[model samples]
Target: MNIEEYRLYCLSKKGVTESIPFSKLPNVLVFKVKGKMFTATDINTFDSFSIKCEPETIEELRLQYDALEEPPYFSKKHWSRVVVDGSISDKILYEWLDISYRLVVAKLTKKERLELEHL
Candidate 1:
């Protein structure tokens, strides 16, 4: 998918907000839920994006998908850089994005999660 499609998909999730938080990398857009980041991508070059992954399954995913690789700026064990080179299908990409969102949501405080549910 293209950048607009990716951005819209992320924004469609409940309580998700987008921001360009890094001054050094102004083109990099981060998508967060309740102020905690779940995924991010460079708007100028939507070739890839980073998403949180379960540490237990990160290695397996990397091994299974050639498009998945170690993220440049995130914990290797908890995040995966997904190359948007069309090697993977959009359906699978959306599923991985959903998993990332859910993982971040699962870590929210009880009150935050409740707030998110109401959004």
Candidate 2:
């Protein structure tokens, strides 16, 4: 899918906020839930995005999908870079994005989660 599609999908999640926190890379848009980043992509290129993934299943996912790759600047074990080259379906892309969001939300502090629940 394209950048606008990606942005709208991410924003559709509860409590998600978009920001360009990096001054040096202003085009890199980060999507976060309750201030914790879940995924990010370069708006200028719209080529790929980095997302958090389950470490236990990450390698298997990489092996299963050619579009999945090591992220440029994130922990190789916990994050994946998914190339948006039309090699994968939009449904799979949305599923991966949902997983990333849920993983981050799962790690939120009790109070933070409660805050999110109320939001």
lDDT of each: 0.96, 0.96
**Candidate number achieving the greatest TM-score relative to the actual structure:** 1
Q: Candidate 2's C-alpha lDDT?
A: 0.96
Candidate 1 local lDDT, 37-59, one digit each (tens): 99999998899999999999999
lDDT of 2 at 71: 94
Candidate 2 vs. true structure, TM-score: 0.97
Score every model by TM-score: 0.98, 0.97
For candidate 2, lDDT tens digit of each residue in 87-113?
A: 999999999999999999999999989
Cα distance off (Å), candidate 1, residue 51: 0.2
